[model samples]
Target chain A: MLLEVSAEKRFGNFLLDAEFALDCKRCGIFGPSGSGKSTLVHMLAGLLKPDRGKISIAGTPVFDAARGINIPPEKRRVGLVFQHSHLFPNMSVQANLYYGWRRTRKSDRKIGPGALTTALNLDHLLKRDVNSLSGGERRRVAVGRTLLACPRLILLDEPLTGLDAELKSQIMPYLKKVFTEFDVPMLFISHSLQEMRLMTDEVLIPENGCCRKRMSTEELARSSMTSVPRSYVNLLTLRRPQAHNDIWIYSWGDEKLRLIEPGEPGDNLFELGASDITLFKRHPEATSARNILPCKVVEIFGSGGRVGVELEGGGGRLVSQIVHESVRELDIQNGSELFAVIKASAFRKIC
Target chain B: MLLSPQDMQAVWLSIKVATTATLVTAPFGFGIAYFFSFARMPGKYLLECLVNLPLVLPPVVVGYLLLLFFGQSGFAGPLLKFFDLRIIFTLTGAVIASAVVGFPLLVRAIRIGMDNIDIHYIQAARTLGAGRLDTLLTIILPLSGRAILAGMTLMFARSLGEFGATIILAGNIPGVTQTIPLAIYDYANTPDGDRMAMSLCLVSIALSFAVLLASEALARSFRKGSADAP
Candidate 1:
């Protein structure tokens, strides 16, 4: 879906003037709180009218102030999942899930209720009241409810904002599964870099009520390394875990790495901080760390006092964060070979 | 049990008038409450003031205005004449008076209910492909059911004890427009009629107590229904 928007809206002291055009299926609007991320979502969904501008979805003009055209939200076919699951209090889980499906035109109903229930794992809770569900279950049902509408584009406005860490992890996989299976275009909005990396490929950064930048999700994450407290977070997709006595062994591409934490079978995502990987000029013997690999320095580029060493080894790539002084002492440069040491316990499973 | 045939007629007429007034006012009450709670039209505060004027003003003053409006030379006089309807000194006039007098209470209750509902629910329904009227009927209306019931109960109780308005508009006819309060008023005015007046007062209390109890029971059931799985 191609979403084109050029709109301006003012709420007293705050004015949101956004102009952008995106054609990606998975796009994100990333910004801090009160930076007008939600305002843009509301405009796209037709819940909040833009003061003066034009908005078109897939070449259809949904809103054009100059042309005197403004479609209502129900006719726009732009579904939204709010932060809190605002499921109808009077409806059962089944009723809430099908509320949109029942209203969608037969020709437009691409996602069926049965398939949605199975995908969202909501079949067991169909007979339960909405208030009885847990936070993660409510979010799953909310996503299911929106998907059943078969919208042209779905907007998720900080859908996991208030959830705890464990609940957030539980809901992310379902979100990924739905977008993949249904092939529906979505605009994911959130402030967390981790969520953006996991859910979207490209991101639009909104600041001070305007979208100032548009870049790849990886570029955005890397740029934040200098400012974010965590330095840099390396996302690793590991699979085929085997129990190795006291530890778990996982395969990364063609290389096997031992981890202290055990993971379930199949593909698992883990976050290893760039600061956690210690670089050595030569292979160090008798170290307590379990994982050590000889890697070639592919690139060395960063700002501020910290430098990022891009490593290519273990049949994959990893970035190690180190101080500038260390870079000089180790004489690190492009195409230089080094040993990267990491403790097995440093790997944190995200999902 | 302690009254004449005319007293019995008055007792039955009170129930009929109160029931009719409450039923007729319910839909309009809900509509006005919705408008107040959600609509963003200009001059809304003015409309609100008009709707709530009867609540603060004296009921006798409300009846007097209705009397003139439906009188021969009043604003609605030509309209009533066109429809060949008589509103003054009739049971219909009693119902109109009761409805107008109790309207503010009913609207207040429903508006509170609607206001308490989260705005996101309405937005969610709209994005989920439900139109304006569809959302109102399916979401807003059902969510505020208890509030509507409470409003109706308040209106019904108010209509049962509606004295000043009913007396002025429908008059104190013994077997026609006289309700329980009007009957009690008559007995209190006559010589050696204290027993009849006291008995009618007791009946009024019992009727009001019954309405309150019924509303409580209904509200409890509504709560349980929403909590249980379908």
Candidate 2:
């Protein structure tokens, strides 16, 4: 879906002036609190009217101030999953899931209840009241309810922010599966960089009530290394896990990685901080870290006292952050060969 | 068995008038409550004050206003004449008086219920492709069902005990517009009629108690229905 929005709004003292045109299946509206990310979502979904602007989805104008055309939310065919599940307390899970589908035009309904219920794993809880479901279960049901509406563009307004670390991991896969299976375009909004990387390929950064930049998701993550307190986070998606006695071995591209955590048989995502990887000029004769890989430097970039070294090894690319003095001592440069040592505990399973 | 034929008529007439008044006022009350709870419009405070005027004013004062509005050579004189409907000193007049006196209580209960409903539910329904009317009927109505029942019960009880307004407008006729309170008024005024008046008072207490119990039971069922899905 292509979303085009150029709108301005003023709320008492804060002013929001955002203009952007994005065409991507998975887009992220990345911003801190009070940065107008939600305001943009609301305007696009037709819940909040823009003062003077035109917003179009897939080449059709949903809101045009010059033409006096402001489509109501129900007619916009843009679904939204709120931060809280906001499931109708009076409805059963089945009824809540089908509420949107029943209201949609017959011809416009592309997703069936049978497929959605199975995809969301809601068959067992269909007869249960919405209030009785757990937090993660409620979120899954909320996603199902929005997807069943067959919206052209789905806006997720920090859907996972309310969940804990464990529940966030549990619900991320379900969200990924539904979006990919249904092929619906989505704009994920959140303040979490990890969530942005997991859910979107491209991102729009808004700051202080203004849109600052638009770039690839990876680029945004890389550029944020210098500013974010956590530094750079290396996201790894490994597959085909095998139990190795006390530890688990997962295949990473052409190499295998040993970790203390066990992963599912199919695929699992893990996060390794750049600062966790120590680069050595020669192969380490002995070390307490579990995994050590021979890699060649692909790129070196960053500023200040810290620098990021992009390595092409261990079956894929990994970025390691080190001080400027270390870069000089190791003589790190493009095409430089080195061995990267990482502890097994450094790899945190995200999902 | 404890009363004459006239007393029995008064008992039945009280129930009829109260029931009719409650049933007639309920829909309008819900509509007005919904407006006050949700709708954004100009001059809303004025309308709110007008709707609540009967609550603070004496019931007799309300009856006098209604009498003037529906009386011959009054504001609605020509309209009533064209319809050829006589409201003065009739059963309908008694019902109108009861309804006017009880409307504020009904609206107040329902409005409080509506105010307590989270706005997100309405937004969720709207984004889910339900239109305005659909959201109101399917979501708002069912969610506020208990409150609506509570409001109806309060109005019914108030109507049963309405004395000042009915006597002023319906004139306490025998076997016609005289409800329980009007009949009690008659018995209390007559010499040596204290026992009959006391009996009617006991019956009033019993009726009010039954209304309260039935409403409580209905509210409990509503709660159970929401808690346990079908």
* Number of the top DockQ candidate: 1
lDDT of 1 at A82: 91
lDDT of 2 by residue, A170-228 (tens): 99988999999999999999999999999999999988888747999999989989987
Q: What tens-digit string does per-residue lDDT give for candidate 2 at B9-79?
A: 99899999999999999999999999999989999999999999999999999999889998898899889
What lDDT score is found at residue B112 in candidate 2?
A: 88
Per-residue alpha-carbon lDDT of model 1 for A140-160, expressed as tens digits? Answer: 999999999999999998999
Please give the distance, in angstroms, between residue A29's alpha carbon in candidate 2 and its true position after superposition: 1.4
Estimated TM-score for each candidate? 0.97, 0.97
Cα lDDT tens digits, model 1, B1-230, are 68778888888999999999999999999999999999999999999999999999999999999999999999999999999999998999999999999999999999998898888889999999999999999988888889999999999999999988889999998788999999988898999899988888887888899999999999987774333221
Worst 10 residues of 2 chain B by lDDT: B221-230
**Once model 1 is optimally superposed onto the true structure by TM-score, how far is the C-alpha of residue A180 displaced, in angstroms?**
1.2
State residue B48's C-alpha deviation in candidate 1, in Å: 1.2
| Cα lDDT for residue A296, candidate 2 | 97
Alpha carbon deviation, residue A344, candidate 1 (Å): 0.8
